[model samples]
Target: MRHARDFAVTVLVLGLLGVVAGVLWSLLAPRPPYVMTGEGPFLADPSTQALIADDGWFAVVTGAIGLACGAVGYSLSRRGRPLAVVLGLAAGGLLASYLATLVGGAVNLAPASITASGKAVSVFPGPLALTAHGVMYAWPTLAVGLFFALEGIAGYRDSPLRTPFGGQDPYGPLSSYDISDR
Candidate 1:
């Protein structure tokens, strides 16, 4: 029951983390500047392929999110197994990435036009015509890898052998340096 509770809390925290990451990605993502012609109602379609092709900004965003997820997983699963955290991160990351992509999809190559007087047109809000490639899965993969790496590092640090020599010193330094004396 405790384990189940822990898992739920971890997922909730990671999900919130994903939301923050997604918002940041959307805000930081760059788009090609374009102006619509006043010929007729324009349907501005900005695909993710073009957005990622220029600089792979999506990949960068996913990688950063994965690293953060891994760190959080490590912190949460200190008393348990890292696998649990990894799984939570994977699920949370996928959901978060999808939502983030949708938010970012709102920004199209050409701004929407509702009204125009001369050369300037008033833009309208609409759905973003963006698509997701394998970039969306990058977060979970990287996050799992990072969690294991951190777990291994933490294990190594705790693996150092300690032998008692004398007195109350756990590492057996010297009688004069014994902690029991103090």
Candidate 2:
């Protein structure tokens, strides 16, 4: 029951953090410049760097948020079941990633303008978009990876194989060694 509660809380917190990540991505990601002509919008520059940069920004922001979520979830679930906590992290990460994309895209809607007799009229920045859709997985991947890495470290520290001598303790008793042996 406690584990279930903790899992629910973790998921909820991560989902909320996704909204923040979306806002941050929208604010930080750069939009490609486009010329609004009579025909349609066209890229001002031939280079696709701006489009790629937008995806990069989204990945960076979401990845960072995911890492934070993993750390927080691990800390909160110390007394809970690892499996349940991991599932929560995975499910929450997916929700957060999806929400981030939706919120960021909504926040970055194309600007409205009336182009009369438009012939290479005004130059407006395009909306934020992910050129590489795979970037969306950044959140969940990082979240789960971080959680496992932390769990492994903690497990290793508490394992009986580890000893104060920096090696395996075959004797099974620390007191068995004479104090003068040091």
TM-score, per-candidate, Cα-based: 0.62, 0.79
Compare the candidates by TM-score and give the number of the best one: 2
Model 2 / residue 89 / CA error / Å? 1.2
Model 1: number of clashes? 2
lDDT of 1 by residue, 14-37 (tens): 667666655666566654434355
Clashes (N, CA, C under 3 Å) per candidate: 2, 0
Model 2, 55-136: lDDT tens digits are 9999999999899888877786687577778888898888888888888877865564545465425767787778899988
Cα-based lDDT for every prediction: 0.64, 0.83
Flag clash pairs in model 1: 105-128, 165-172
Candidate 2 residue 31 C-alpha distance from true site, Å: 0.8
